[model samples]
Target: MTAPSRPPSDVSAGVGLAGLVGLFAWLAVCRAWPAIAFHLGLATPLEPLSGPTAALAAVLFSGLAMALWSVLVDKVHRRPSTGIDWTRPRPLDEVIDISITKIAGLWATWAVIGFAYCVARWYWQGQYVFAMEVLGAAMLPLFVLSVPYVLWLDRVLVDPRDGAWHFGAMLIGREACDPEQVRIHWRAWAVKGFFCAFMISILPPGWAELTRLDWAEVFASPFAMTHWLTELLFLVDVQIAMVGYLLTCKPLDAQIRSANPHLAGWVAALVCYPPFILMGPGSPLDYHYGTADWSVWLAGWPAPLLWLWGGVLVALTAVYAWATVAFGLRFSNLTWRGTLTNGPYRWTRHPAYLSKNLFWWLSTLPFLVTTHNVNDAVRNTAIMALVSAVYFWRAKTEEAHLLAEDPKYREYHAWMEQAPTLTRALGRLLGAARRRPALQPAE
Candidate 1:
């Protein structure tokens, strides 16, 4: 008989929670460094880390801390899921050619991404400027480091002929390569290329706001406090997520297993992000045309009500951030790095999407427009509904991808279907609606 199935999650609660603790600890230190320097009687007191460099450093710190926790405490490197066999490393002569091929594939991938960045006008404009500058600076180091890194990693990889190897083989017309592996290689790189820039671009603004804020002023108003806290949570989410994108090492068991192969999945995810976002101002799904925020709509309301509304919004934002934290170092869009079934994930399959949509609706109050035109109100509310529908589509696509890729995810999906959660409830409702026979035409 088959043995009883273990817990459905690949990631444990302690693993992610430990990483969260490490992240917050480092953030606290970064925030306190200037004061610490002043107390030590330095000639030039260290300034608050409010620059883009400092924000990038925060990503490094967060990534390092999470890596330590995963390796030392969780010992994820020993897991079979990593597809690494540290016990039996191959001889250098055996894997050198394979490593060389992989490195060639990797370098060519970076060159293509760099070329795309140069050609894309959006990368040079607005918030993307910082991303381009950071990537440009690191390009040399990344290229130099890949030789040794690939050479070392290939020795222990269970099968070194991964997607990158396949792509390399195809490029040089060497051994036969699977076309599907080449496709997966491009898909994974495309995800990393698009998102890493976007994440880096937005980091500085939030870091600057957080580091420069005066506590006195921030605490003076409910709205101000809520807004500041919300930004802080979002900053945490971005920093952790950037780490996930950068640290796809097998030793940490954070390497992506597969990117979503479905075109619908890519379309669903890309439309929600830069260069293709439909919900931005003046875009097709723009929902903020005439709607004022909660603060504006509820201005002059009772202080208690203001506090309550602000608190709820902040709580929702916190849940969204927590969903990212739950992934620890495995967070990314359109990739199955691993299964996460703890933290906010225990409550719903898509806590981030659910909380995010709710936050937008509650915060924007699209039904109450500043224009005082019934038409404006109706239009804004309808647009907001469409935005939520887009997220729903994104959720479905992600579920399909994950369900197909990993047995662990399938188990988690089954467990969640039985568990008393909003996802399960919705799943049942959808199942019932589908099962119900269409109304018979008059006989």
Candidate 2:
């Protein structure tokens, strides 16, 4: 008779919970390898490696990051897992092994993309080191936040196995076993808290600018008018997205079904966030065209026509905001909430991406239209194209995930394809939103 299947590895087959923690740390390192290389002065901005000293320091930093992971796990583990639910609990060890392995595989898939990027750039020019640095730097936070953050998305007992149930539950407005389940609550709060704070911080200045807009000066000519409307649409877009965000499910009503657990998916989707790669600490790794820059495409139009073009741009952004409203409080950076089939969603599977990309094609100006330097224009255009490709990829991943959890999503998906804009579709969406059941958050 065949021997029982060999356990996956020394850790998965041997150690139990400790092995799971170690496995997570190891996968995290794989994700961060490029960044570590940079710190070692191994990437493009290479320097004299203070050989032994640098090695020692790198070892310490690696140890520290891992220690932080262990600390988080231990603290998260102290509570009774919310994953102990109405269903029969599966064997925790088996679940842990499977979850850890799957998540690790996802992170490794990101590394594969990094390697592919490196090869592409290297073949074009001898830029291996620079390419590695760019990919690694971007991948750093993506991997670090990935394992911990994704625990909220799990629908199975694996959430408890990883001690993520408490924080994950708390994040989606579920009743927590304790108020201070761990510092994860702080992390969760910091995420939404910072978003609100940033939105508020910008409003006063934005509103002031909008009011201060010189109407006569803006109407000087068609090009001038185009510029004014572009700025106006941007101001309005930001406000709507934030307002819709504030209206989303609060803890009292929100129930997170699953989070997007794939590492590449998180990275692909998050690269769209300004803080992730736009105006914040990690912004340097990405450069692309934003909606704000689109008005340049409307240059030379008559004032009336310019207004029309600007109206289209603003309308697309409104679709973005409406998707937020349709989806509701369950709306989040990476988690699954109830699927929305009405509002703009009734018109298209991905209204945000579709409208945003169409806006890009219209606005491919800035460097693309104005620059004489073909190399610079091409490179900039290519990067934005890559960014658009990432969003499309995120849409597919989201579809796959939703379909897995709810066969209803498949039926909904099919219906949208056949009769997405029918009056019946709108009626169904209206009814679903009205009738959607929400359980009370834990007492």
Candidate 3:
């Protein structure tokens, strides 16, 4: 009996030691070891700190630990078979291999760098601004939004698959058919999904809760309202532009991984349910703790009606566009994640992504009042700013990637150069009209 129990006892002992080590390291970095001491009921000479300082330190350490775990957990406990190295990805699919590698590598690096910047600062100063705190909470949503933006842009322009974007939709889409395998890997999907959901849900609550803490006098004013309204309009403009991509986009599975690997990233964003939940003060943190108006929206027949509208008018438009791209569009030779050609594709390079961003902003407007206003301005600004950069980056990447796929891309490029002619011409005409000396009759 003693011999049989030894293994179990040893395993528990090892786990306990690791947990203790992690907790100690975290507490030490934040310089707020008192909380841990209190938790353990150990009497300490130091006073316990509270308010933003303590909150900042706690969050900084928590985020840093999460980043490290995110990097390591993927390959842990799995060994490479034969000569294959688990450290180096064995290409599972032809088109996806490059995209996956780039996505994974980028995520590992981004998570580390982004978290490290915060941790190092916290160690030095022991606190961060409420704005940074709010922005930090929105990181997941911003990360989620980054993927499809990268993939769609890459498909449009052409470039080498750098794996920077973690858009993993195609990979998961393929795996969806095999539920058993997906279940096993579901943790990975969950890790990715968790971040996206955090970005969408945590943001509204963070602002709402923070407001209740008494920053109202600091953040409320006409200037604040003006800035928010300006940012809100910018957000709306960006999303409206996104609709064109949604109407005409294709499927994820059909594309080669080498070119458009981050399809999983796109799928992850959508699969986590509609971004609509994040629109108005978000789904309440506590089921019982929601705004009165929101409560009215959620109860009875109205709730079901809103859900259907959100699903059909908003979510389905994007999904349908993705399906159109997957199924193969007429007249366009682009492959899955290929050059924009179908529906809105013929007009603009990115329609679906632009639309999703627009809808997300539209939904979030009601919740952006008062203290959350600052947070909304910062988060939406960052997201839209990043989206704009992604647009140009994907185009350049796609252009380079397509060199081998279709040398005719050069011809396509030249044609596009000339093709913007009509749009450019129209713009010039409008500008000239506006400039023309306002008809003297008006004077």
Q: Which candidate tops TM-score?
A: 1
- C-alpha lDDT of candidate 3 relative to the true structure: 0.36
**At residue 345, what lDDT does model 3 achieve?**
38
Q: What lDDT score belongs to each candidate, Candidate 1 first?
A: 0.88, 0.48, 0.36
User: What is the Cα-based TM-score of model 2?
Assistant: 0.46
Once fitted onto the true fold, the runs of candidate 2 whose alpha carbons sit more than 4 angstroms away are: 1-204, 214-237, 243-252, 278-298, 301-305, 366-369, 420-443
Residue 355, model 1, lDDT = 96
lDDT of 1: 0.88
Give me the runs in candidate 1 sitting further than 4 Å from their true place: 1-6, 40-46, 425-443
* Residue pairs whose backbone atoms clash in candidate 2: 153-258, 153-259, 175-442, 248-329, 249-329
lDDT tens digits by residue: candidate 1, 1-443: 44334345666656556656766776676677789778988775587767888888888777887888888888999999899999999999999999888888899999999999999999999999999999999999999999999999899999999999998998888889999999999999999999999999988998887887778867988999889889989988898888889888899999988999999999999999989999888999998887889999898999999999999999999999888888888889999998887788887989999999999999999999878999989999999999999999999999999999888888888777677778778888999999999999998
Pairs that clash in candidate 1? none
Q: Per-residue CA lDDT of candidate 2, range 256-338, in tens?
A: 44555556766676666544554233354243423235555555667677767666765665666455434432345555545
**After aligning candidate 3 to the native by TM-score, how far in Å is the CA of 172 from where it should be?**
32
Best by lDDT: 1
Write model 3 residue lDDT over 1-443, tens digit each, in one string.
22211111101122212322343354343344456677778776444333344433333333333223322442212322111223443233433544554455445555754665466443233223343554467669757875655443343223323223323322434322333332323333333332322322222322222223333542464333323333323322222212212222112111222322244333423333333232223342111112233223333555456545444334424532342322221111112223333344333444544554455444443333334456554655554445434444544444555554453444444454455433355667999999898556744
User: After best superposition, candidate 2 residue 102: deviation in angstroms?
Assistant: 29
Query: Regarding TM-score, does 2 or 3 come out ahead?
Result: 2
Error of 1 at 377 (Å): 0.3
